[model samples]
Target: MPRTQAGDPLTERTIRVLDAVLDDFGGRRFAVRDWTGRRHDPPGPAEFELILTGPGSLRAMFFPLNDRTFGEAYVTRAIDVEGDLVAAMRVAYTIIETRVPAAVRARQLRLLLTLPRAGTGRPRELRARRGGRAHSVARDRRVNDFHYSRSNDFYRLWLDEWMAYTCGYFRTDADSLDAAQVQKFDLVCRKLRLREGDRLLDVGCGWGGLAIHAARHYGAVVHAVTNSTAQAELAAERVAAAGLAGRCRIELTDFRALDDTRRYDHVSSVGLVEHLGPAVWRTYLAKVWRLLEPGGTLLNHGMTGKAGEPVGSPFLDAYVFPDARLMTIGATVRAAEDAGFEILDVENLRRHYARTIRAWRERLDAAEAEAVALVGDRTVRVYRIYFAGLEHAYRRGRINLHQTLLQKSPAGRTDLPMSREDWYAPPQR
Candidate 1:
């Protein structure tokens, strides 16, 4: 047990301030331990413990008063969470969302102001640098580079064998991550009704997993586009190694800049819509529609928020995704309809995403030493907390994953397939 200020006793005023904050927290299952070895246990069983390292810890975490500030405090080790990180994040999210009385808030602020400010050491990795206007091609490229241009070896430490970064489709909770990823790719192919020599366009293709899979399995010729130079290089290598050089073309270019002369029989955009920002949904969908031939199918897979929830958080925007935004399924469907797309099917894979992220976190934990060697401790910590928080959000219905299928029907003509029987039939060996 560490003592605060050379064994100085905790003041009554300090206890009062802590109590006020915890009272507003209700009956969350967590414990708090402040400096001087004082513990404030919850009314019930605790799933995690938050340790405040010094008298200045609370001030450092709350005085600046924003999610990004608190996040920086945690990353710098002023405040630490032990055991059940997902549960701890749930409580933290609730605290952020809760509103306290004005009088109580003022009193808490006064108490916090009296405490000394803690010294936070330099973090191993700095926060992402912001630049230019949001959603512009230059700005979007910067954001993509910030997240995806990190060393491919670092990502390979935990991602599936194919380096699929998006959600996986699990047949059951017991399915392995690799198996579920394969299932997800096959699912996309079946939804498109891909056939031999059919042309497929993969927008925002990460590492060329789905593109190679489609060419190898369904005999489809695929064109995949990405904005990250790192991803494009690795994907090109993977495509060549898979003997798909003639069938799959990997382009290091923005999806918006694709030539309009080319048209595809099927299009798939997985895990890409979140970065488009809400204002660009109409433009995004219109572009996809233009790239598809009449009677063509398009499958859009991405994360979504609840109907009335806001799209982005300051902490995530600054530390993690930087300008990424989420939209509700209702909003996405409306945008597609407005772009003259006929909705065919909508499926929510929220539960599977929860399992998928949990698996990633576990694998990353097992390879923590290797990850740190690859990307430094600060980057590892950022992703650790991010994956845990995302899993909790999916499990609690705060976020959702949707696979929406749409068709471009010209003259009320849609291609065949009256039933989904073909989707479930076992692949021919």
Candidate 2:
């Protein structure tokens, strides 16, 4: 807390109220400084500092005291995180988890009343547009355009060579993003037991990474689907460049729009389930099941919410992914089972995601100027916050990355090996 200044009751009151509200935050690894340039250090070493620029900044940060408002303050420069952003994010998350008493809330509002009120910044474009039924095909197209229609160059700035947008598997912190992404794609293909001339379907195939991998490395015939127009165009270009034009096809449409005339030996849906509503879980999985040949495997990779974690990031929904929503792992598995897919394997990749997001954040920070030029300053700022928040969430187990392996198995028949030994065995000499 700030030292009591003589004849400065306002400072004293602000300190008391803010401190009291944050009393539950015992692990204060970061300091909080008010607008007056007064730094209030916690009782120990600090890795970062939360800097509030003015009275409006304080109001914007603490009035509602949620993820969305705190995000707004940062995007508009009302509040700032000095020093390590991830460390500061840790502290901010703790504060959000702190439940203020009703008395504290009352005192905060009363104190805010005396402070000047201005420049909280305009609200975000809510869910890209309101009034439509959530997750409808038309509404979803608009949402995809809002989030994914940004310059492909912007994403290419940080993503790997394949431009895979999903989480990558990491053996250690030292692995490069490209290496991890290769391992991830190959891992998915190996899990499906891909072979030459086998048909593979990739739904929600961002930038066509997995499809390209299946075709180039596994020699599988690839058919990929994506709703983002930008993704479809770029992926098509990439496919042709890889000289797999005859074997690979990129479809510019939603996964649901696919005709029933075709089926695949393997189906992969990575980083897409979160964009689907929980109510549509059965429908989505059933579609994947119908698209897969009996005895074929389907790899469903996505981030899911834990039972007790905070529901969703309003900031993410508004600014990052307008249609994203997480369902619990158990719920996801149950849905797949109900959709006629037998659960074969479930592995959590939470730590991998932490490293993946951290790498992206650091890469973005290093290429700040290029990113800003490509997508403008606001988008860069929003994504920086998005990465930091996600890294923190993964570290805290608020979210999980699940690679759920399901099979369109006929009873007692699921091709070959009964054990997972081959899944991790060393390569033959």
Candidate 3:
């Protein structure tokens, strides 16, 4: 009960705010509290807890923030989550999707705008220092070292068992990361219509996950190429462990150096193109075109922006992936066509990535005790922020994951008598 006239108005306003949040959250119930709104000095029991306190106390479920602050907190091991990060993200996104009043949204945007931009004088200076050119081999090693040499143990703490550093495709509700990875590998193989006699080339194969899969399951001869020495060595060890020594070979060489006369029936590169940078994107595509046999399929799985040329995130560049850059669909199409490969299909696994990152973050959070011990405080913080930031990017459509399937022409036309590759259920299901 309100004691004063003003108290009633405040109580009514709080209720409205809570209701609005719930409405936006697809009618899912939540217990909300006012840590930001109430309890100035002496924090009450309900101050941090999700419970009602008094007249102005509102109750609704609140999502753990996934903003820049959350990222920083995760990196620092401040906040934690209990279960199903993917579901939590979906709930969070749905709530964010609700249209807030223009005034409120504008105020939030203004605050964001007021934050000091992280820049080196001008964006041009940042771009110029990197000089849109692939410099000497010595210079290139710096970029590779910056990103890839960030400890295999550190990556395994969060990534799948196969050390797959890309978005996973989940099939069933009960599927674990291991299962999703196996399914994703099979999906790619099925998409390429891989057969036992097929000679497969995995471009930028990270730790040889796909190569091992193809060799073991489809009995394909796989040549996995990667520039990272750590990846090559680890991939070889993994292949030998899987008894795939006869069917697969992992090479520590750049795709540019692949000038073999033999062609591949299927070529795939998972989450590798962004490192090629702007200058070599075209050249990279040309190499892929030359590597694939006529009538063969190529799968390029990487991130892309939805609209106009997306600028790189400064925070990500400095703290996460140093030389990584995202491309747009239009640019990818142009590059593939210029390289003489016809685009057969382009699927945006944008939402799937949001879910994937959420799952990864959740897993990382769950194993925090062990992860922090394995990699220390700084590394854990970096990943927490990285995964959350990545989730936000995908959810907001700022960045995306695209699986574009391209095919080289055999009879000057792409039409082939291939069986239906949809024999297995779709990835979304």
Candidate 4:
């Protein structure tokens, strides 16, 4: 490692930038390591350390920096975090909230530019490369493929046995991820009042977990749809292996492409609406309304942005779910109502989602080598930071998980039970 001697220009500039950032943010829980192996300890005990591997690391992270740049730097190894990633993120979030005067930011940019560019190297395939008009079937398919087709085996390493990639309902903090996921599926089924011989549609069913569960347990005839070819293929295998071929079918199609004439007794859109983008919320709700039989239930489950949260982050948009957008619960409900669906119940499971994502992060960390082998280090880093940041966001109430129960009422009638008693009933043996 190169050492920065006294009067070194690079060392002087690095220290100046670091001091400016620390002074503006009051950072005290984390330390920073410069390219010359020089350490700047925080005022308080450090929980994590930000390691700038080269001169360009800071430039790569801070120059033209936005919410996405830090993530990109981490994934490309221009910057690395040692120790608690979540803790590091908390500090970062605090710093982001701190206001810096424009003049100060401009001065920092000047200093950043003077440092040699740490070539980001061949831009690792960190973002989706989909083409076509956003939200169009062709584009949506490409986006979903980019996110879900990475590796089913890789997902299996972290996801529960059911392979659910959504928030799990934890009756208690003691519940295991698998148990909570099972509870979540059951909760949705109960809310929908699923019954034997009913026709069910699961939009954006990931690996057919909920579809198979609903079919096997509730005896519903389930038709699941997804745009990812890999997901559909694996879901078909899971459905068949569960001896549910007669009861469940997984289709490689978009939710928007589903035939409108076919009516379902119940419809479930879990962790899918985020990808619909706010612009298509009405279209999405109306389509689901048309697909439901009279008095049929529709459970729309997904993440909701806080009232004042930014619309979207560049990092997530580019790397995670391309073109995905989150809407507030109020907006979501209004759209459903406008589509002629009456909102029966709305539940916020923000803490549950926080716990769920934390579990995912831990599992991913435990399987770091396998994950890297499966998807390369860059992809793993993307997920690592993403999951950690998501967990933090949920914990802080910046976002929430909403399970909304809606009904396509026939003759202004909802056949729902008198109270919420049934939803909490003990599961039958």
Clashing pairs in 2: none
RMSD of each: 2.8, 2.4, 8.2, 2.6
What TM-score do all the candidates reach, one by one? 0.93, 0.93, 0.71, 0.95
CA lDDT scores, all candidates in order: 0.84, 0.81, 0.66, 0.85
In the range 18-133, model 3's lDDT, one tens digit per residue, is: 44444433443333333233321111121121223343222112222223332333333233333333333344445444567887655434433432232211112212133334
Model 1, span 120-195: residue lDDT tens: 8535356678689988888888888998988899999899999999989988768899989999999999989999
Where does candidate 2 stray beyond 4 Å? 1-13, 27-29, 33-36, 99-114, 123-127, 425-429
Report lDDT (Cα) of residue 373, candidate 1: 94
Collision count for each candidate, in order: 0, 0, 7, 1
- Give model 4's TM-score versus the native structure: 0.95
- Please say which candidate is ahead in lDDT: 2 or 3: 2
lDDT of 4 by residue, 1-429 (tens): 122245457766776676666566653556777777777676667788889888788778766757687788888889899888888777666655446789877776777787778787624466788787889999999998989999999999999998999989999869999999999999999998889999999999999999999999999999999999989999999998999999999999988888989999999999988888777778888888888889998999999999877768788888998998899999999888888888899999999999999999999999999999999988999999999889988999998999999999977887677898989786895
Q: How well is each residue in 1-429 modelled by candidate 2, as lDDT tens digits?
A: 434334345544555656665555654456767767677776777788878677666667655767877777788778889788877677667777656787866765676565555486744633367348988888888888788888888898899988889889886678899989988987888788899999999988889989998899889999999989999999999999999999999998887788887988988889989999787667778787777787988889999999977768878888888768899999899888877888889999999999999889988989999998987777788898889989988998989999999998888486657777766653332
Order candidates by TM-score, high to low: 4, 1, 2, 3
Superposition-based RMSD of candidate 2 using all C-alpha atoms, in angstroms: 2.4
Off by over 4 Å in 1: 1-8, 11-16, 35-40, 121-125
| Residue 125 in model 1: lDDT | 55
lDDT of 1 at 208: 94
